[model samples]
Target: MVDTNETHVIVGAGLAGAKAAETLRSEGFTGRVILLGDEREKPYERPGLSKKFLTGAEERDALRVHDPSWYTAHEVELHLGQPVTALDREAKEVRLGDGTAIRYQKLLLATGSSPRPLRVPGADLAGVHYLRRLPHAERLRAVLRNLGRENGQLLIVGAGWIGLEVAAAARGYGAEVTVVEPQPTPLYGVLGPELGGFFADLHRDRGVSFQLGASITEVVGQDGMVLAALTDTGEELPAHAMLIGIGAAPDTALAEAAGLEIAPREEGGGVAVDASLRTADPDVFAAGDLASAYHPVFGRRLRVEHWANALNGGPAAARAMLGREVVYDRLPYFFSDQYDLGMEYSGYAAPGEYAQVVIRGDAGKREFIAFWLDGENRVLAGMNVNVWDVTDPIQRLVRSRRPVDPERLADPGVPLDALPG
Candidate 1:
């Protein structure tokens, strides 16, 4: 039974924060639920920032995680646009940007990450954007609409999911698109060069150009507006607009200032937490991208930045905070859509952690289920591209941790369900 008078405070009003607040209410907690956010707007679904929302297929309110009425009805205090500036562990309080100090019985740090800024010259110029927030996406959509088809050039830096998605959107707007990726191929590190090449080919077939294994040395501008991007190889790519999609760094200043333990950079840096999402201080828990959580299946700590981690991790952290026995061992999952290519990935393994990749369909056709297996032929991770309804079997194979003949795994005739567990 929850003490109704107690207070539970959640920082960051993103998916993780909103989910945690909702979970608290559903778990019979009548205590005060305070959801703090740095943005003025209500919590919303972030995936749309790069997809439907950017494409003008969805409305602004459609992205909200919950309606304003829902928050009011649930009695969840809306502290929008007020960022937590300090965490006073001794006082068990969080100081907001407005200098308001609120005490809490239990605190959840779900402060998500921000785009890693491009530190090169001319990065501050006009016509350059980063797609991490709703406003960023809105501005980009406006640029695309104004630029008109075949009227301007858009140069995207990085070949990760965000970069590729933007490239697709820009191309759809009739903008000439060029992607500069330092990696040998798009998504090479995660999907491997072979699968990554398939994506490269996909973009190429759609009239999108790429400069693989290339890095932008500087962004050349004229009159405070972006003109072109110069590469290290002395090649200058003309661009009317540019987007930096390198990656994101977790927002950990508040946690660090509070003297919370942080994971090493190599382990995906963030506030360190055990399997139960509990920080060194039992009263505090960390979840979402800001949490470097220990994963039992991987036998290591992982900080995932995808939407699924926040979806599952938030509730897991909430339950743990309530003194419930909970283990956050869900397999990492993420999906992407670029043009005609739709893909879903389950499980996690850094590149080269697994020994081999087994394919069950044609990669050339872009309809396939690929499995990453260890030396013992145990599935470490699996992904389905342009394929449907096989996620369950693929996840089952990874979770079972049993060895199976790769030949059977790769044979469509064998059936995914028939694979030895």
Candidate 2:
């Protein structure tokens, strides 16, 4: 039976919070649903911030997860620009930044994450940028357009997905981009050294320069405008602007203050939750990037900051909050677009977790499937680059947790489904 008197509050009006509210309504929860956000903008997806929106291929309106009227029509109380400042578990209420307090029977923290800031000198200069919110993207878009016209140089710190995507977007606008990464190769942490060279070459072919195995020590600027970046390798790279894309840390301040358990940094730190997405506090739950949720299949806690995680995690958490069974065993999945290459990676295989990487098709052509396997040749993760309709089989292979012959795994003629999972 639905309790119309009960009120459910969701903090952080990103994709996760928005979807959670929608799910509550769709699941016949005839209760008060309040979605609060720190940003004035309505709930929106982040994937476009680094992709189409950055390149001017898509407008800002297109990034919104739902139309403004949807919230009103669904009776979901949407509060914009009002961040929750405190969570009072005993009182069952959340205090807003303006000192407004709202009571709730249940709470969901979909606070998402923030980009890690560059700690180097002059990092606070006017031209230094980071891509996380809508405002950041707007500023970056303008900067890229202006730089492209002037043929200005853009120095990017870190070679992760955001850095490389921005590199491709800047290149699209004809801006000179130089990526400085401490790792030996681009995407070394995710793809590892085996396939990182492929991404390095992809960016290089399109006029992008890379400062591999080096870190930026200082940002040189005059009059609050960035002029160049000095690397630890003793090389000063010229730049009109700089982008810091090292990584993101979960926004867990509210959860922490409320005494929620947090996972260790090595376990992908965030508010720790069980398989059902419920935190140590039964009435409280965490989802999206703010959640380090226990995965039943993987038998470990994982905090994924991808679009898919927010897209699916939100709904899963909503169901769990409604007392439905939710294991949240969805395999880790993410996709990236850079230049002409589009790729989707499924499953998780951190460095040292997989012993072998098997490739089917041509890596040079960038149309291939790369599989990460354990010592027993069990599929751990698989990435399909410029390949279509293979996600199902790839996910099945990883889920099967069975060993397959390495040679067959690499053979193009061997049907993936035919192989022993």
Who wins the TM-score comparison?
2
- Backbone collisions counted per model: 1, 0
lDDT (10s digit) by residue, model 2, range 1-421: 3455899999989999999999999998998999999999999999999999999999999999999899989999999999899999999999999999999998999999999988978899889999999999999999999999999999999999999999999999999999999999999999899989999999999999999999989998999899999999999999999999999999988899888999999778999999889999999999999999998767899999999999999999999889998888899999999999999999999887889899999998899999999998999999999998999999999999899999999999999989886
Per-residue C-alpha lDDT of model 1 across residues 1-421, encoded as one tens digit per residue:
3455799999999999999999999897888999999998899888889988887889899998888899989889989999899999999999998899999999999998999998898899999899988899999998877665547888999999999999888877887889999999999867887678888999999989999888998998889999999998889999999989999999999999999999999778999999999999999999999999999988899999999999889999999988899999999899998888899999986777888989989888889999999999999999999999988999899889999999999998998999876
Q: Model 1 clash pairs? A: 150-174
Judge candidate 1 against the unseen true structure and give its global Cα lDDT, from 0 to 1.
0.91
Candidate 2: which stretches are off by over 4 Å?
1-4
How close is every model to the real structure, measured as TM-score?
0.98, 0.99
Model 1 misplaced stretches (Cα beyond 4 Å): 1-4
Candidates' RMSD to native: 1.4, 1.2
